[model samples]
Target chain A: MFPLSPILSPKGQGGGLRILTHVLALSPLAVLAWDFARGDLGANPIREVQFRTGKYTLVLLVLTLSCTPLSMLPGLKWVARFRRSLGLYAFAYAGLHFLNFIGLDYGFNLRLLREDIFEKRYAFVGLAAFLSLLPLAVTSGSGWARRLGKKREQLHRLIYLAAILTIVHFAWQDKAKTVEPLVYGGVVAGLLLVRVVGWVRRAARGTGSQTSSKEP
Target chain B: MDKIRSSEITPEHIYLGRRQFLVGAGALTASLVFLGGCRRLSELAPTPEADFCGSATAGATSDELGDPLSACDAATHYNNFYEFSLEKDDVAELARGFKTSPWTVQVGGLVNKPKTFDVDDLRRNFPPEERVYRMRCVEAWSVVVPWLGFPLAKLLKEVEPTSKAKYVRFESLHDPKQMPGQKDRSFQWPYIEGLRLDEAMHDLTLLATGMYGKPMPPQNGAPIRLVVPWKYGFKNIKSIVKIDLVEEMPTSLWTAFAPQEYGFYANVNPDVSHPRWSQSSERRLGERARRETIPFNGYAEKVARLYEGMDLRTSY
Candidate 1:
């Protein structure tokens, strides 16, 4: 039901829908902060914070992946402008989740922190997913676009890798409940399938064509 | 048809009975039922069915230390009962239709006297008492529950364990019509759990029939379930229908489902982190601060000796 044209107008990239997406993207944290302020994070606030932030990161990662496919849809090209906000919010949440685990949970016990990051497969993968997103998040700007030119597109493609790692991280982390993770995995798989199918179509068209459409 | 009422608090005993445990402590449980009798069992708020014994004289503890009780609402709402659904809230909603009556447990395998005991038989044989215990999950969340049941050791002793019985395997009820999540094959049907013979014999391991004093809601594994405090919550297999004493160490639902991730003895050793996450600390349910996880969930003095020579990191 959201009207996308006004927010993603040609000249005004940061329009109504962009602002709305930013608000929606970051609202879970606001609710969480409210939960913290109200002492409503159940028994363990640290775990709650870690869990919510991680979930938001994963969800935003998935949502970010969906933005490109949405752009490909007829009349929905404007949705691409919303992707950068999603990506940044995803990174911010991932940072919060990481900081919560290391700072509050482990209290920066480097040995133990090292053990979680370097040793635990789930932790390692989660950290890897966040690390993969770091460069993409940093370069998600018009300035980076002006400076890097064609290189910006290549660097931003790491978002796809980040998406895959994030799904893997979620799937591996959950113990008994595979339904939610599998659903998320299915969504990521579907998104990747879209990309793969498009790549195959482009390859079939011919290699000599220099106007190969860059994926958003 | 075979449902044990609150009045039938069985006194038959081989070891210390509920009376010996409770009455010996001198004082009775006080009449302080939280928030009043107006509590209603709705989807919004958990009305903890009053503890069967309002004033259980014997105080339950992890070791010598007492576990602060978890809010009943949070415990019932935040269950990992994948048999019904993966979503925590859906557990109660989806499980509302489950029929927990007419349940019978087959005490079989290497036991001296293998017999099928109905729910009533179990209640008639072993009196349930309130035990406030630290219930930890592999997901790194925890709760201190006031469980109503007797030691599993007592039941194993009742049938008289054969010398060959080195392990005790507990199996959950398998009714697809009732448990919808079983339809997905996410976990093997009729969830199974196990303990070393010594672990089963330990007084702390209980066969929980109820929580917060009233009969356990179906969402929390109604009829009956195992409550191994030191072990992860999955080890406390819900709606158990079989207690199989076996010669070999049995493969529990989790261990068989994913041997790489879950171990037979899912002890609470923060040092031995899960492959996916840090187990160094856990968030107690209904509270905010992440607390350091205790070895064997603070029951190391009682159970650590069982694994004196075994390497926990590998086995776990």
Candidate 2:
């Protein structure tokens, strides 16, 4: 609020915002790598890596969802430009989370992996979330968005479904303390609620105008 | 005895920093309680200068399977004591102010001679011995620890169990003021666990007082805790205040909470998987790769006979 030029950059076409988003997104990975290199990953390093990556993915996904709501505000229109980058970063972390699970934890054993997908509920939900995010990530390029047109929006609505699945995956994975995942679920619910209320209002306004025009 | 490498140990500065923080926090809590004109729920006892096992002359061995002992920091800091906290890393800090000194454990209910034994007396009566054990958690993690304590059978023998005693029930302290987790209704307070009389009297069942040549940290269940190597980690109750020899099979907290997931006889059988995940292999702390989990956590040869006729799959 104090100064917009530093963050938004008047003539830079959201260049400052883009730089800020990249810095925010990549810093978690950099810190993780630094911790790994310094042997500070703690007792269960594999578990630690998996936990941090999964948590980062959730955080980025939540932020990506927030941009649309924030863009509706008068001065926050530039936030919409950061959504695609944030989603892609979330996907990257999810990919790393899956890799750590299958490779580091399970040693890339196909039989074990297959069994895990079929038998483990948490694993199944995690896999579903990753698969849903895959298409959105692949189609994030402007060329693909233009080629698909209206269908792209339809396909990208899968983010909502993916976020729910991700939350379920996290809640199911926890052993006893469920407060953390429940808090994430609460935030996602609030964001979805905002979208739902807005849609309802728009629908009601459209119906009123249609009736008024027909009477005239 | 094999010494843990210096590099494996936690740096002295970090360890001392944690100690200083604990002391500072304890002083702050005391001052706040004093100023508020309320009786403190439980005051932190000054740290015991020496370990109860410090006077032990008996020598100890390394891990029975020749595996390296887990670092002292990992064994002490990382815990699953739900009484203090649900988070593994938070337990150490949260349990810092727990009172362990001036404790007593009541042994009664179907015993020929019921007696309330002071913790210090128990330490003196039963000389401490070190036993290196491989502990397997239901969450598919394992650690090898050098625990200092005497066999549970020694204590069980002191107060002879009547013929009616079929199972031994252990109850942890239930002061909600001291244990924050107990305040939550998710789990019934005063965590309870039980073992079959034979299992309780088994040669391998230990009443651990310390680990890593130091007094048991509060997070690891100071004063005393059970160490049943042949079972899942949950079966080893912590900070026990009461022991009762009962006529009927007693229900453990996990068993009561989720009967299907946690059974009364939670013997570690890799072939029998947990409902949520496979227990076929476990990630050993400080190790790069997962290793195949062993039945009875590698103590099968010594304890398998106990479950010779019973179907482990059904029991599990």
Candidate 3:
């Protein structure tokens, strides 16, 4: 019988899948850079960058959350190995989105940015969401996860809150067409509820595992 | 918030055949009043020549008070044509294949003589004039453009609206083959907008057939469109197919979709904000810096009287 290698090295050459993942993850930035150079970002380039990066971050974050459920299925435990990488990419995209706003909108004017952080409720919410993701990104290393034990899992649960806040920030900005944001919010809400339903059932069974489904 | 594009980030015309610069306004007269004394509703008159009319000539905008007009590319590309698409740039692509000819605007409902005139005949009947007006959107972005068309009041007069007609509703073409976005069913098809009777008769109100001295681009609402400069951009309904003069106030596309956000009048008021966002400030298309939006887009002197005695905060 062929042995199942559960812990796939997301960055290692041991599996060709890691190379594919790396290429796929970083290709969006390359395409964006090409588009920017080609002047294909349309009339409002800054907005295009900000919107695309934000959307990419949301998509990757959703993907990271989906990994746990997929890994729980038999013979698919290897999907969990990509969660940290997906999360790290989501954080990277989020950083790009925020930086686009700061550099383009405020031109690094700290006073203006501070005023915005106070005046713009969406900006405040965005800052909170980013700050929440910062620690998760920093401690994404497997060694740190091992040291903190279960506390690390609790800290990462803040991601769901961050996702909701991010959608709120997005929805608030969309004044004209709201259905798009509402659709995104609904998707995230459904993902969170799915996780909670499983969590509750486990708690009811007296095996209340706080960590992810494939915690090992 | 305003955005500054880096020197490296220049705009390239993604769509082919997009006009870059505005053509000079040669044959346009910015006459303020189309109808003067001794004028009946059915009476039609050719455009009064400046040399012949002498003192009776309607005063036109001779001097400009504000900045230069927005570039043709920016005005054409950055549009909010929901029928074609939602995103500004996508509309330019989606509407490129649209056919704009053989168009007729049907003027009916509570009118003395209901008529359907081809868009060409309408343009010829009322001599096209030039109007450089600042268009402010509810989204807080603005643009100043040279729109070429005649007063909308002229067309409303030709139809001879009955006294019972208190409102004028404008409807856009709803074919999905021409406008791909209609397939989504997100918004009610056949986008409709309306203006009060007096507001429709205002000289500033125009049946814009063209912009930048050229025929209106399909993406920017070709054939025929309305332009109420003092109101929000959405009030300037595009690709209009029907003009109905109704007794009661008619519901519009934006207001019907979201009543709290889009009011019926939609007159530009810096004091009255959209529920979700502030209308106090606007970012000009070319200039990225945010500027304080003026009351009625700085034409309060002409339009403020229309909203007299009404609470702007509540009405909005």
Best lDDT among the predictions, by candidate number: 2
Taking the tens digit of each residue's C-alpha lDDT, what string does model 3 give over A22-104?
A: 55667677767867786666566677788778877776777677777766766556667667888898899999999987877
Error of 2 at A32 (Å): 2.0
Using all chains and alpha carbons, the TM-scores for the candidates as numbered come to: 0.77, 0.83, 0.77
lDDT of 3 by residue, B171-276 (tens): 9998988788778665777889999999999999999988776677787789899999999999999999999999888898778788877899888887775544
DockQ of 3: 0.07
lDDT of 1: 0.75
Off by over 4 Å in 2: A1-11, A197-216, B1-61
In model 3 chain B, where is the ten-residue run with the lowest total lDDT?
B23-32
DockQ-based class of model 1 = incorrect
- Angstrom error at residue A60, model 2: 1.1
Tens digits of per-residue lDDT for model 2, A1-216: 114535555564445445656766777787678667766665677887888889888888887887787777765565576789889999999999999999998899887778768778888999999999999999999999889986887688799889999999998888774697999899999998887776677667777575322100
Give the top-scoring candidate (TM-score).
Answer: 2
Using DockQ as the measure, the top candidate is 2
lDDT of each: 0.75, 0.80, 0.75
Q: Candidate 1 at A72: error in angstroms? A: 4.9
